[model samples]
Target: QQQVKQSPQSLIVQKGGIPIINCAYENTAFDYFPWYQQFPGKGPALLIAIRPDVSEKKEGRFTISFNKSAKQFSLHIMDSQPGDSATYFCAASIVGYQKVTFGIGTKLQVIP
Candidate 1:
């Protein structure tokens, strides 16, 4: 089952704008939620993450808001720059599980 779902296949933003990406999961067993940022020709790298115990987390210009009961999460990039253009993905996994389920991904373009 494709438990993770992402929205807005693509997004466009001007420099210094904020871009938001959202995701949802179906499996209650999923306890870990992580968002990844991928630039062309590179592997996805962890950007930020949160556990169900935490409602939200922020690091640098990236922030993650999690809703435990709704089984949903979202990522927001503040002061987005042209260099921030990339593909973002949301993922869900069990604490000790080897497999991680990923969302479809959102391509963000920050225009100067």
Candidate 2:
């Protein structure tokens, strides 16, 4: 099986922050671009992701910690901005299965 090429998909933090989500995958079919956010009765939304050619995607304040060789990835948000408050469902999609397997979404409320 071929390894996923990117180490961390455009994830960087300018300063110290807390890590909230940790995802590890063994399946080669698992998506390299792993990011999905869903709401009640709503379709899954793709928030921040990078293309195959890019290794890092940085938006203001959003941070990510990823280890591609270990097949592990995590997300962190700095400042706890009001916009970050949401029940986030972090998930991975299997290419062949046509399914998204995720844990019970984590309801995060950061007030600062």
Candidate 3:
């Protein structure tokens, strides 16, 4: 239980549309779940996050749905916009661990 992976190397979400991407982890030991959003050539920034104690979390137009038993989670972009077009990554880490493991990455394009 130490690996998390995501799919759909890329996604296209029209203006004002919603785009969802799924992720699964192998480690149940992970307690901190964080989704990051990155612009072109930029470092990933924390978007929204959920702990295993919570089922869902939302921040502004971004939402994270989590499953504890299945060791799965997903990110949802609501009312997406062209400005929101960017790369997203799902990551996890155990408590007391400063390092986090990240997925390959997902590129999202919100067309206007």
lDDT of 2 at 85: 52
The best-first sequence of candidates by TM-score reads 1, 3, 2
TM-score of each: 0.97, 0.59, 0.95
Residue 47 lDDT, candidate 2, scale 0-100 = 62
lDDT (C-alpha) at residue 40 in model 3: 88
Per residue, candidate 1 scores C-alpha lDDT tens digits across 27-104 of 999999999999999999999999999998999999999999888999999999999999999999999989999999
How many angstroms is residue 15 displaced in model 3 relative to the true structure, after the best TM-score fit?
A: 0.6
- Which sections of candidate 2 miss by over 4 Å? 1-19, 38-44, 50-56, 94-97
CA lDDT of each prediction against the hidden true structure:
0.94, 0.52, 0.89
Candidate with best lDDT: 1
For residue 93, model 1's alpha carbon misses the true position, in angstroms, by: 0.1
C-alpha lDDT of residue 84 in model 2: 59
lDDT of candidate 1 at residue 110, scale 0 to 100? 100
User: What's model 1's overall lDDT?
Assistant: 0.94
Single out the weakest 10-residue window by summed lDDT for candidate 1. 1-10
Show the lowest summed lDDT stretch of 10 residues, model 2: 2-11
Question: What digit string (tens of lDDT, one per residue) describes model 2 on residues 1-112?
Answer: 3232222322222234442655565664555445555555677676665323344555666554555566665556656554455555455565566766564455555454
